[model samples]
Target: MKNLKPMLLEVNANPSMRIEHEKELSPGVFENVPSPVDEEVKVAVIRDTLRLVDPHKQKKKDRLDHDVSTAPEAGLPSLCLKQVFPKYAKQFNYLRLVDRVAALFIRFLGVKGTTKLGPTGFRTFIRNCKLSNSNFSMASVDILYIDITRRWNSVGIDHKESGMCWQAFVEAFFFLAQKKYKSLPLPEQVASLIDFCEYHLAVLDEKRLVCGRGIVERRNALVTCQTDGLQLTPAAHTPLLNRMATASKLADYRNHQY
Candidate 1:
């Protein structure tokens, strides 16, 4: 019998998105030095879609028609609100813009492959959440996190909130930031957890000379609450979402759950 060891899983953190800088490759593509994912645009698109269906209907397969009726009518197949919204629909045209010039500071520590949660090495990275704290595994999701992290840092978003920042984002949502090439903040980390959907999961739109359409301007300012008087604002109202989870919740979710 061939002594068989388990095979490692490979995750494509930096999937090839061929948009580059200065040197134009095609007629339509622009030369973006830095890229950031347009979180607002993503939110706008998703909000439009959710008008009809629950965006998080994971169990339901894509078979039924949830028509929104906005075309020639007769020939049009069943649709969701995603089809109706124009700005959101046009968003795909700017996939290249996801990596803005401001998104270059991120440092991606490459790992071999997606580490199995069962392994002892993943103790910290896979601790309370899906991964252990110290576990250094390379999954596709890490790429998204790297992108988003650098992008957010550029635009002045140090979000340390509950829903938008912690539970829905953090480790679970880091994959979106790991693309390494282009990154941006996402609108809805999970479906129901998000209330307002100005955009789905996109970076800012910096084309056509348009700046700050859907996003709330987040300057690099942290509201300092002294030793006592720190009034907390809700995450829904702010553009910051890069916060760590509550201590007890994090501890319970990671170290104590077992």
Candidate 2:
């Protein structure tokens, strides 16, 4: 595991608009990282294509016509682990979870000769996990709490969060300050969250620039709320998604869901 100390020290000492320097490595390659799995690992990679396709529908598979459209086009596949532990999938939305897990897997397990998961060795790891191909480009996704703790612990943080999203980062930042740094007060902890994201912009992966866009939007929204007399409390900070799912049940409210 890589220590974030050097990266942190460098950025803090000499902050600049110029981009930070990074190694020129190929995609999915990390230096000196080890495979996340071991003999003790109970989760196993599955390679059954039948799980994703209807074998009886051979005619459909043979068709080459792009004009033939279908409602609900074929969705991304699923990981064997989901099948083995159906209970886990029931608790969380697997579609989103798989993206983050796949990113971690690529970072740590892209070595040669590792057990393959699909068609090509890499594809096996991917399709078996049902990862979005776009995950290769994602800066970060909402990660599982366990994954966050595991990664943070590996890098020497005795205490950690479930994931490193803005919410988690904000809490951790204030936690370091003993919850007394109250220069900027709002509906909740909006300013503190933005502050953490601002600092993190320099340290996040270069490819994560896209992810930075969302953080910028959220930070601006918080600033606007502060300027306009809108409260920024934890309770008030509920995302539009929650509002859509709860308060807005009628068809007219659907447009606000975005």
Candidate 3:
């Protein structure tokens, strides 16, 4: 038995010889030896590999959440505006500044914060503002406008106090815009117009200038239209004589006829 054990040890030391002997003695024993992989480990490896290869799946196992109140307030960045439109920034009044910022923010809410504003888009924006935030006493238009104006002035875009009528305000803005952006790129011009339109509506609201009321009031004034003649008719028309003072030529015509 001792001699047999020594021979077996010698055979086991040579792995090739031992395997051949084992196969001949018990071929089925190796066949039933269980696989080394744990099922849970295999499943986890496959899941990880799949996440890397598949573009549709997100690699990050967790997502971040943001609260609305935590997000910064959206508005025209005066510093950016000053750089973008230097001339307008320097000359724009406080009221004009307020209009532009409020209009752009309010209008953005109308289109879910995308797309260009339309001609009558502000009318719709006013409706949306009332619905969403209403006259919440805390953040009323007056308070908001004041805040915006102060910020704009701080950025060196010095605000002038001009309670000018809405028409004059709009005319002055467009004039400066034309001069400033005439040679600039198309994108800058379009952006200015968009901002200007928003500002226009805001100034009107703040000033309480009604387009319809202004038109009606002007139409009712007799002196609103210019004239040059006695009855104050249009200057382009023939002059009006004070009276029909030219003597009749009847007597002279009668003598000539005889």
Candidate 4:
């Protein structure tokens, strides 16, 4: 029973449960301790620490990290006007177009540092800025707006709090420019359009550019054929005769001609 008692004590022992006093009391000395203020302080400290390191909160953070890593737009850099619009890289006036758009965006919202716009705000911007005027038809403007809205929604942006960034405005502007100047050669049209809106280069996508080059090549081929007045249809292949029959025909033709 004595050995069992010592084993029970060992099993019950916890280092953290034991509190050490800074000052030791002498033998036969008794000091009246104050109210459990020190103990209360220790309990509060432990409670706060537990709250801060809650397992549930840690799990939520981990989930958020995983979502961010796996998101479709994960590796894409924040849309930058200069990087996307390389054609206007050296032009300060063109680069300032980003600032101009940003300023107007925030001004319309009446909120400082707010760079995003909801669907209604975007529509208002187009109307107020006269973006749909002149060469840009209302139908095309609506289409562009819908396209931007769909893209913005696909990224899981909450419409209640978040909206499309200013970069989308630049994209829409360039889209309209392309529509307006559809007849001109692509490079020449782009160059001419850039003079009006310095940020026109921002609309170009690498994949779209590759596809455009293919279309341009085909167009050039068609134009060449037309200029030469060549038949549009492919020439029919001549059927091959037997080798012996071909040789005899050639010999007969040679003899008859000579």
Best by lDDT: 4
Over 1-258, each residue of candidate 1 has an lDDT whose tens digit, in order, gives: 024443333246663443334546599775665333434333433444564565334344542354424323335333323343345756653342223211211111113332112112222222222331233445433543445444544554544421112222333333423322133344322222121111221222233224543232332133233312344455443444433445556777887667
Task: State how far residue 8 of model 4 sits from its true place (Å).
Answer: 68
Please provide TM-scores, in order, for all candidate models, with all chains considered together.
0.15, 0.15, 0.18, 0.31
Whole-model lDDT, candidate 3?
A: 0.41
RMSD of each: 29.4, 29.6, 29.2, 24.6
Assess candidate 2 and give its lDDT: 0.40
The alpha-carbon deviation from the true structure for residue 164 of candidate 1, after best TM-score superposition, in angstroms, is 12
lDDT of 4 at 148: 82
Task: Name model 1 segments beyond 4 Å from true.
Answer: 1-127, 131-141, 157-258
**Model 3 bad stretches (over 4 Å):** 1-203, 206-212, 222-246, 249-258
Off by over 4 Å in 2: 1-54, 58-95, 108-258
Error (Å) of candidate 2 at residue 228 is 61
Which residue pairs in model 4 clash with each other? none
- Score each candidate by Cα lDDT: 0.34, 0.40, 0.41, 0.57
For candidate 3, lDDT tens digit of each residue in 93-199? 43355466444544443345333333234334434333223323323433433444344345533234322223322343344345446886644654575565556
Predicted structure with the largest TM-score when compared to the true one: 4
What's the CA error at residue 116 for candidate 3, in Å? 5.3
